[model samples]
Target: MGLEPDNMSGSSPEDIVNAVFGHFDPKNPLTFKDEQFNSDPILSEKALCLVYILGADTIQFTDDRLIEKLQTVRQRISEKEIPQVIVMTKVDEACSLVRNDLRKIYSSKKIKDKMQECSDLVGVPLSYIYPVKNYHEEIDTKNDIDVLVLRALTHIVKIANDKLLRSDFNKEQPLTYKDQHYSCDPELSDQSFCLVYVIDANIVQYTDDRLIDKLKILCQRKGKTDP
Candidate 1:
């Protein structure tokens, strides 16, 4: 689901909010539904992740109003624990080194700092943010451009896939660790155990030895100790 460029840059807050929440066109009765806007995982079909695309060159040019809009969306999405990623597009325009050669993106400290800035602004971790150059002026598709774009997309897909797999396991059986009742469903338990290690390590903030021991015990009780 792509948003119009104006929705992020020039639109009023109210309009931006409406666009994020999604609006129904009266003329198109068949397409008029709130599902497009709804972020609820249970209500919506496969709400795996939310990707926020920000132009590399526009970050400094963005006004407070736009930042407020982004914050509002970030807060709402965070509440749901939905994985968020910032696609920092147009790195070529932002850094001269990258503009000369896309392969220099990772080695360029300037690009790294720009990515960090985006991460800090969006309140997402640096690992989740991806920097990529858009093929704006290229007459022919370049391998370097493709590689950068593909790398960003690959990360996004992997994160989304992990979320979907976890969600599916959750649906089969909820893994509630509070009351000593780990999921009785063996498949669910196994998947949850795998997820505990597979999901972004940053997501699991509490990783003390005691907590690890408890989880290991829980897995053992479920007959799968390997995590």
Candidate 2:
């Protein structure tokens, strides 16, 4: 599922990547659900504020504010169990904010003037963010909007397929490590495991070679490891 819409800017990277179909509706602007946007335990009010700035009726999605939003998005992504793809649209306009050189947007003289404030807001490297625009062209009977959408979808699939995950432990009994939980069905179906780590919960991570042995010892002492 996606996080939020970027209003004038378009969908976020995470939204773009996660969406199976449909991009943000330019007509209907809205923010992310408070429950999901506030998912990260370490996320501060500033993070929410950055998102608010990006998707608000005002703020114009400046590079500085955009960078801060991207950083918060990255932090939110890291906290999630899945990798995310962010797509910031209407970037054709942001190009005007750059200096004449334009070798890199952030390196441009205008953007450089606000570097300190931008960095303070967004704790992410500039290299990771990508800016793009989708303008409907009438000059060509067969325009490339569909192609761009297809390309975006293909890229999202690639990212989803390339996500880094914990090594499969299919053969072994699922263990309690980090926030991973394990429970058996009385009907004897396959076990279920939910590992929503990187967020706060009353979960445990006691499972190194030594720690596993120690836990086994204690479980056995209390008769919690039989069967």
For model 1, residues 92-140, the per-residue Cα lDDT tens digits are: 8889988887788899888888887788777889999888878767799
C-alpha RMSD for every candidate: 6.5, 13.4
lDDT of 2 by residue, 2-68 (tens): 2333445646555532221222333443335533333323211211112112211122444554554
Q: Could you say which candidate leads in TM-score? A: 1
Runs in model 2 with CA error above 4 Å?
1-76, 96-127, 136-153, 164-227
* lDDT at 214, model 1: 73
TM for candidate 1 is 0.66
Give me the runs in candidate 1 sitting further than 4 Å from their true place.
1-46, 168-227
In every candidate, how many clashes are there?
0, 6
Distance from true location, Cα of 77 in model 2, Å: 3.9
Q: Candidate 2 clashing pairs? A: 12-87, 13-85, 13-86, 13-87, 14-85, 14-86
lDDT of 2: 0.40
